[model samples]
Target: MCLLLLAGRADAAPIGYSITGGSVDIDVKLDGVVIGTSAGVALTGDSIMMDTAALTLNALRIEIAPTLISLSTHFGGFDEISVESAIIEGDITFANLWSQDTGTPGLFSVGAGPLLVTGSWGATDSTGINAGTSGQPITFPVPTITGIIDASPGLRIDSVTMHSIEGTPFGEAGKHLTIVASYSIETEVSIVPEPGTGLLVAMGLTALAWHRRSGSGAGPAPRG
Candidate 1:
């Protein structure tokens, strides 16, 4: 016989978020993996949010890429700019409140790589010089995940990353800046069986076994 326990109360989960910025491009990595990127998107806003489904998640690693764009006029002789950034957020559910502390129920990390800048510029009559800058690498601190759990409740997380880039006019030396930002959120759930259900199943199996044993004994006595 097989016995099944009742479902236990759902425990609240923990959610967290992290943000980072760069001069030209931004890369958002979750749990040491890249999930998303944005180029020339603009960073005027303090934060941005992305759909969790857009990210690649299988057990742990997340992969992402940046969006691109083009410009009509060149600033400081630069024809175009590319910006990128990374952001991550999400929640983890627990079977029960005690389990959350006893076991590592929810935890996550965020990080950023060096900024990459690439563009072209032309010389003007006044300065007689046109120059462009290529992409460069940069690094930033990793983000940490933290949150509190609730009784039989779900957890929510929100995070955003921002980036910006600038180009200068050849002769005038005036610069134009481009910015981009992105964000995302994730949610996880856990389930457990209740004590009462387990006990009920155990009793049911025991009763069936006893009844079978008594019936077999009666048949043997009749045969004798």
Candidate 2:
């Protein structure tokens, strides 16, 4: 029989974090099985945490940060700027709190994760840099940024990656641009029992114990 075993407490307290930028996509796992996924919301960089104290789960992942992806640009000498790409070049750092020793800060690492980029572009003669009458963007398809990433075992990670997309508009040899965009992250979190369910269970058990003890200690029903 295949016996899956783990050696950590799934009921550990939540780890606090503050996202400086970008939204995140979160999923949770228990014993290698996915329990559920939650959509990420934009944060104002406030210190917060994902609660995991009542869970028996053992796995967490940063599945995909699609919402967190962003774009920045730097352009000069051009009168018009077209953001043909969301991310031209960038860097991101991730941290896995599950792998660190208790009471100490966790270690961080870099991963070459999924990204988004441009698939095509128009040239200087295709026209539309300076003489283009209307300011309608020449649309380009977004391409998938796929690749493998590296990380340590026994860790729950939350990460943010930042990228800068730079480009020079066609025919406008004098315009410049400096753009910055942050990419979304995909991550997995630990799952626990339904919210408030664990607490109710604990309370029920305690009440039951008190009732049993009280009955056992009471004398036989008062003589009628």
Candidate 3:
């Protein structure tokens, strides 16, 4: 789905994202603080890095759709927003587009300005449903991911850097691989409610009334 792009907000939730399933190493930081990082894991065909023709950073956006929080914990326990994958598609043109593990070429810098992230969120839980809604993909017995979002900047082309460590699957045992990125970060999270929750509630109330008036609970007093 299309993400959001708005000016900076003073009151926004600290946005967070995650990546899963890939044989790669990556670390993302906002300014100097590390928000998300990965050692050397083996993910399948995940994480896409594309290049953009826009020579300069003309626009920026970050977006995060509020997902379901498991309701089976303690009176609706602290469920986590699991991020399965991440798609970073923007235009980042440094100096060297191709390097062979010779230690980051020369001028290593990013575009100026606040790295605005759309799906990243405008505020934490600020965009979620505060009231109870219908049942999501999360059920009692077995649970499967109900939603998937691609916060992709959608501005692509090419560029990448790989670092192989020892003892990794691609090589020996203790070797691994990794990719790294750095930028000034400001984040926000939103609560994207299930559109069907409202309808579910209405139906439930109607059912309850019908049940109460079904048998003995039906009809009024005998005009007494």
* Candidate No. with top TM-score: 1
The Cα error of candidate 3 at residue 115, in Å, is: 15
Cα error, residue 145 of model 1, in Å, equals: 14
* lDDT at residue 107 of model 2 (Cα atoms): 28
Error of 2 at 84 (Å): 20
TM-score of each: 0.29, 0.27, 0.19
Worst 10 residues of 2 by lDDT: 1-10
Candidate no. 2 TM-score: 0.27
Question: Would you list the C-alpha lDDT of every candidate in the order shown?
Answer: 0.31, 0.30, 0.27
The number of clashing residue pairs in model 2 is 42
State the local distance difference test value for candidate 2. Answer: 0.30
Off by over 4 Å in 3: 1-191, 219-224
Q: Output the better candidate (2/3) by TM-score.
A: 2
Off-target runs (Cα >4 Å) in candidate 1 are 1-10, 15-63, 84-132, 138-161, 166-176, 182-224
Candidate 2, position 24, lDDT: 38
